[model samples]
Target: LKAGNMVGPRVYSTGTILYGADGDFKAVINSLDDARSSLRRLKAVGAFSVKSYNQPRREQRQQIIEAARELQMEVVPEGGSNYFNNMTMILDGHTGIEHNPPVWPVYKDVKALWNATRVGYTPTLIVSYGTQFGENYWYDRTEVWKNDHLLSFTPPSVIDSRSRRRTTAEYGDYGHIDIAKSVKYIADGGTKINLGSHGQLQGLGAHWELWMLAQGGMTPMQALRCATMNGAAYLGMDKEIGSLETGKLADMVVLNENPLDDIRNSESIKYVMVNGRMYDTDSMNEIGNREKPRLRFWWQMTRGGDMINLPVNNTETHLFGVQEGD
Candidate 1:
């Protein structure tokens, strides 16, 4: 089947999935017949989920949910940080709500929604409310940018972008307390919260997400569950990937310290095994670290390795942009 930004019946009948469709991409399925026909067409071609981009009105969402249920398909809705849409999606029914909802005036009906339906929640804390914690808080943390494991894979430009950046506080709001408090509220009330870092900073982003979840009021175990089992269950992969069970895949991390004592310790990783293949995280740092014959740096390389002849370059140097001096 051809894949592209195809629209209309071909998108579903021929198996083209729309990743982000705001307000059902303006295709109104108002009647039951319209809903049934549309969803049945999708299911016939093996489409299982409908992704809404934070714009569907309550009735529209309800219709989508009803149609999905009748067809045994899942509706995964993203509310784009809008409080009303997020709450409505949760109430109306969904497989998961993407990212944390807006922080101000926390959603009070979350527990009711949880009791009513089996919806999953993904906070996507790192990109969504990470800056809300405070610019100074992130900047002052030595470990965020200094960790050898992170710096090994992270580009100097990415590090610079995240470092020393000012928050919206310049306009008078100095912090992200509301979002943090709301996160704590939802977790405490027993809603199934899942971890989502939005793919920022690669592997290191998950640790940052867990740390922020702890800051938001989750116990270390609860936050860890959000990172592990909750996410697996949401993706329908818990039977295989979430825990260290006998029949599950051998995927797990060996940490240097107990993350239960402090979530930040999650970053202190020693080894990671996926599908029974073990990786020395420290040794993985060396693979792309050097140019043997001549010294040319692609990105920041952690110091003190056997690649001695290769001179280390300044981490602040941008690879593409050049100024006056050589």
Candidate 2:
């Protein structure tokens, strides 16, 4: 996409997760040398950052952070719901913590410690730990499968299976709210709170995250900052991509409504601009900087009276992995 071969949002990924323990995608970081070598390999392959995922010992994780610093790469460690580990990562100079700490109603001690550093926090409230996910709230309240905008790009089979049968939870049972409250608390202390949807759904999940942030006591404008400027800063791209500044990349969403009036209005996207090229939000056809229509997805191409048979087991076939029966 960055090469302009595909039409979509600019994507930056670690390519493969770096694990410390025995699991799929392990990076073999049993020692400091291992950590340095592993990070060097990932950086060589175009990873601007590394995910130091669940390195058991503090020293092992620290080694990864140190290695990342040496390579000028950012280290985004997995929180794994461990408060102690998360605290240590923040103190040890990690770039950011990927998930919530899993503890709610954090006190002054937690906030004070986090505020002392610039380490970023991405709560990913949609899949908040130790509670019902925020994603289910929307599924229970909204007809997600009936959303014309979502259905335009996603396959009906995928959306129907997840949204049609909703998992209703008591209002209090939804843990993401409490988690979000903690997020707002720390954010008020000058901590950078980033918007992360945990890939719960395409495009819309981000709005869900932004709304949940507002539910935690943030003003609509503050919540919008988490979804935009804060995220760009966390990724070390603030100077080039965060706010609308002269000499910065022209990447922005043209919302139909002012989000400051209502956080939910953030999703009222009228147009999207990427690298100065403007596109119509509904059809994603280029309307500025060029004249072109969006290409058809594989599902749009008919195969003898039936839609193309999407790969059921191919993990890379779709944004979300395909299940066995799918």
Total clashing pairs for each candidate: 1, 0
Segments in model 1 whose C-alpha atoms lie over 4 Å from true places: 1-48, 105-110, 129-137, 164-175, 285-326
Q: Write the residue-wise lDDT of candidate 2 on 82-128 in tens digits.
A: 88999899899898899999888899999999999999999999998
Candidate 2, which segments miss by more than 4 Å at Cα?
A: 304-326
Looking at model 1, the pairs that clash are: 132-176
Per-model CA lDDT versus the true structure: 0.63, 0.85
lDDT at position 274, candidate 1: 52
lDDT tens string, model 1, 1-326?
A: 13523211111222433223444444555566666776787778677766644334566667767888888777777657677677777777788887777655465666566646778888776656434543334555543556555555566557766764633244224234456567778667677888876666677767777877777677899889988898778766789888999999777888999988888788787866655545556544222233122222345333432232322332443444335785
lDDT, model 1:
0.63
Query: How close is every model to the real structure, measured as TM-score?
Result: 0.72, 0.91
Error of 1 at 97 (Å): 1.6
CA displacement after TM-score superposition, residue 280 of candidate 2 (Å):
1.0
